[model samples]
Target: MHLDNNTNSEGQKREYCSNGASRGGAKIIKTFSSRNTTQNLGNNRFNNTSNIGAYENNPLIKSGRVSLDKTYNSRTNSKFNNMIPTTYETRDISIVFEEDRQNAKHYDMLEETDDDIIVTGTNCDTPICFKTWEDMELDPRLMENIKKSGYIKPRRIQAFSFPLITAGYDIKGQAETGSGKTAAFLLPIIDKMLKLKFVSMRRTPYALVITPTRELALQIHEQAKKFCLNTPYECAKLYGQLEKSSLNRELDGGCDILIGTPGKLKDFTKNLQINFSKLAFVVIDEADRLLEFNFANDVNEIINSPLCTPISKRQNLLFFATITKELERYSMDWMRKEVATIKNKRENEVNNKIHHNIINVQGLSKNKLVVDLLIDEQKQAEESDLSLRKTLVFVERKKVCNILALMLMNYGIKSASLNGDRLQKDREKAINEFRSGQITVLVATDVAARGIDIFDLDHVIVVDLPKDDFMTYVHRVGRTGRLKKGTATTFYNPETDYDFKDNLIEMLQNLGQDVPDFLQQ
Candidate 1:
């Protein structure tokens, strides 16, 4: 990396360096000594902040410091520097990047890589290596598909999980939502299918992907389909929302990659003659949620049913937003004997994309507080053209979903409600509308917190915190900050949930968020 020595107005020698390779050039404008850094997608450095420029509106640069010379890209000739600007009104995208991941002080305090705590029991025949997707020598078609989907680089989980799964090892991956876990599993599975030239016939499945919610199943289906294009494979989605006849028709059609909920799969196996006898690979997405009482029995029954291939024969991949050591132990009882556990570091696992926060409040003012916050967000969106896409307000009780939806509308905020109690069609419609940007706010329960993937969601506010541990809190706020960095602000009312206080403080501390002493007790 090259360093730029320049003097600020105060005549202090300030050192600014880009993380990218240093390009030797023009004589030093000025010399400074101090450590301050800036990084970006394109290898662009800006140390000449003296002259005034026209494109001063770039939010990443200080308004006064922005100048025509600094804003122009020397290579691409793009107007807004070399980096592609996101459609949303955003500030420095790399500002929150954790330098600790390097040998720097950041990772020393709270590292983003779980290399320290990893447990590898799988006796793989081949050594796991490579740090990026390019190094892996994946299938040409799959690589082309990945680039078409605009993924320039693989995230940490994807980098680590892909090699293991491709080598045919059972793995449990723990990463926050939006960290690209879907591709981490799907890419390897698809590549293996292509390599083996495997094909599934009607009434039989080669691959089974079970998720906690239909929404997540559909999300995975959409991405998996993109990867299956132009290949000798097809993608089918099975959820409770389909009618009996329609579901039967899909089951009759060939399913190279079958994505569905556990309960629906069990129903099909019991009544629709759906077969999984030849299942080669099984992905239990959101494994922790599958263990919840609402789904645990059905999930257990499906995996152990005679229709499913034996655990010893088929490869297994379990993924969750959060999985503790105790929970991992619980999952281990069912996983294969030599399952590989893949976990991103705790600091990185808490959804770093979202700005996490907790605001203490009395129970009664909770509604008003949420309304005021939404109003403020709306006003800011209008002023900055950030385009508030969707705000999800999560509560513990199902009834509160409806109550908050109506109350938000009464307060002049357009809103929707999503919960398990709603009809399957209604549930699908709610998800579709919210995703299409037709709806601004959605009030939901914990049921929608896990497994549901909503892109471009602007914010997630927990009106009432869950009594569960830190994992639930992470999933609740993880609804946003995807598509772009969003906010996860929660309201903490001690009177309503005194038990949540300690976990809240501990989570904030671990996630690198501030914890006020008032909430620490």
Candidate 2:
């Protein structure tokens, strides 16, 4: 196992090893070589003790292998997997659709118009607390559904987002996933679709919503239909591994709205069966997830289609809780110039957000640590007479997920592994069992992590800390304490140290959450 090492500002040795065990069940003690020594990494030998650090400034590993700079691939060693190798190359192309492109460019710039941007100067000074749909004046039927669904008031994000969307302004909204952001955009699209006269085209929806996971696409479609109930508009979901005969029939018959993932949508589009030109409102839910799932190229193709038009000319809404610099760069290149950005409250007390501390565990047994926490939570649940809802345990590898699930089952704790290796049917079944209270624990990878939004999740356990960006750490923990309602715990082995954990603790403290003592070490 590799140990993450560090040095103090004074150039003294620091604890930088993860707590792991030897094959014989003995804890391994990792130390840095202070004396000048050359250590072999792969095929090359460098001074492992040098001030600049061993292998410093080397683009390739000691074995002289070139390393890609992509964060996820670099951290997860995805380069070695069956994952596709992405090559970056620039291209200059002619704009055959020059008219539409100009329109898109103009609108992109228009988004920044000071007089037209209602959210700019006002909300910059205070938290939003107004009725989000005060201006939309949704159809009575949709309002009735919202009432019946027990939604009495709009969330802080919804209050500001609804008006902008209904007014036909392009939006770049950043809010928590469960903060009613889905309905904030969907309600307006459904409202608009209902008012437009229906052209007799079957299966083709006027509005298209894209998400990273099939589960999320279905979830949004259900919510969208609920809003358009009793109206003339109809919504359909398209995804992989479904009966194609039925989907094609629905397309031929004409639908008012389409919700699907990129892969399935791309397949349909290539077959010339799905029409994009008629689409007016395009929604990309969980936009960050699109890139993480390796769907950026596909999403770009969809955006560049004749139907999507340019960002400036078409009505577009991109919604996701986490946004990165890479996403911003992509947006600036493709989205309208005047995109209205609505940011949520930063990690603060009012928001009640929590972040984890990186406890550098060195030479400790990870399995033993996990067992201890599970036992503790089990005991507490029993004492409180609380029926354990579902708990999600995250792991980095499929092999680990299966092994952990088996271990939990051997302990008489019902658990299952959900990963890409499993068949789609099996994955759905496991999720159903977890959601229906049949199983208490579900072990998954990051792909499933981004898609799951189960209400009232009992807890989230991070068996492995992500080596990717800090944003991924946020998304991992984001699975728990949803709406600030639960608790989350991460295992810190001995190899891991307190430096990263300290930064995480500060972030959580700023977000108004309590820090655990174990992490303070």
Candidate 3:
């Protein structure tokens, strides 16, 4: 090694050193023009292909050249990189695709997802959350389904709620729709079932899940099937629409897990001869709706029925989208006294995944405005070279849904109607057509489409706001952002919808959307 000292014209002392493998040998060495040879990196713009002082300051390798993203190491480093170059140059590059833009935007929301986890109740221990579901050492079959379902990481709620339930502690969690609470409870339940196999054949179901609606039950059933397909576990869906003979046959055949609504299941208690001695786990999803919809007596009947085991031997899980005095009181009785309460901390009151807004439509312009929206969407799709996307319009009445569907068709927009009045086959066909993009618009009552996961749905319009239940509004808007980015627009009539304004305003603000004063309370 050799050292050299020099003084620049500014009278600043600089020290330089040279080193090689051998005493007299010379090798590749880096040079920097700085007051100190160590290169203070103090406000000095780097223009050459030399290593930066910090490990995170490495050149962003893009297009076979260095990209001077001020804070760069790799493309996955962070979205906060300063794109404005300081001294290093950039080369010709192609336009970034929408996928890349979405990735960048998703990375940018890391700060927004830094919500706290507030857990309460007795000796319930919080779960150690793994970065990915695979890290939890789940069964290979379950892990495969999770990956196929596009699960990259367990959501915050899933990470926190898993342990409490797995430990046999009753849980009451408050999580909003689309927050992945389904899998949070389902996964732990499935895991427990896989390990609880008996030495001999068991007659009664080992678990029971009661949901507010048949659609939600069916949704959970589908997910259950996906995870339990390759295993020996059997899950059955019980509802009133099924034939008595078929229901009896399924019950006779045997079921390890049962999912259904309280009313239907309560009817089955007398209508079908079944065993419930082995029942161990009970989940009451959407507990608030279960109580409000007058299913409380039926649910209590099922839980306290002599056929089932006592509360001491059973594990209970209750979930609600929001916290309220009534829900809390109801949960205390059903959920064990020392049950764990897991409440998701929200960065905002509204789901960040969906964009929410209201379209003020005059008396006669409602139909015309809807038609215009379809036309503009088509035009924008053609301009962007994207495929025509699907849209859903929610109506308050089954009759209105049919009329709106007809109006849209008369306007030359491919559309269909779906409501509780439609036959099962007809409703299924309508849903299939809309999902396949055969028809670009679907007009339906909220109850008809609950728990329907349309992967690529692009828009949702609420034509008739529910008079009281804000959950109707939440479920309507939540339909669009199911598996991807989506937008929601409500046809607001200030006079009729004045009761909905406060909730609407709160929802918009939680989604980080700008709101008007009239809508604000």
Q: In terms of TM-score, how similar is model 1 to the real structure?
A: 0.72
Clashing pairs in 1: 53-67, 53-68, 100-106, 100-107, 481-486
- Badly placed stretches (over 4 Å) of model 1 are 1-119, 123-127, 324-333, 347-349, 384-386, 482-484
Candidates 1 and 2, the one with greater lDDT: 1
- Residue-by-residue lDDT tens digits, candidate 2, 81-149: 221111222111121122123323322222122111125522246434345344457777777666555
Q: TM-score of every model?
A: 0.72, 0.70, 0.73
Q: What CA root-mean-square deviation does each model show from the true structure?
A: 16.2, 15.4, 22.4
Model 3 lDDT per residue over 1-521, tens place = 33344444345433333222211233422222222222322123322232222223422223223223222223355433222111211111111122223333343343345345678875636545555676566767667666555455777778778867776788887775666677888888777776765322344777788988766776677667666766778777787666778777766555677888898788876553556667778888888777667888898888778888777788888887766788787776676676887776762255556765554433323444465556655665667686557889888876556545644554445677776655443555566566546678888886554456664676788877888877767777878664445677777777688888788777776655666433543
Q: Please name the candidate that would achieve the greatest lDDT relative to the true structure.
A: 1
User: What are the per-residue Cα lDDT tens digits for candidate 1 across 72-92?
Assistant: 333354543221111211112
Question: How much is the lDDT of residue 266 in candidate 3?
Answer: 88
Model 2 — TM-score against the truth? Answer: 0.70
Query: On lDDT, who's better, 2 or 3?
Result: 3
Off by over 4 Å in 3: 1-116, 124-127, 198-203, 252-254, 382-385, 448-450, 516-521
lDDT of all predictions: 0.63, 0.59, 0.62
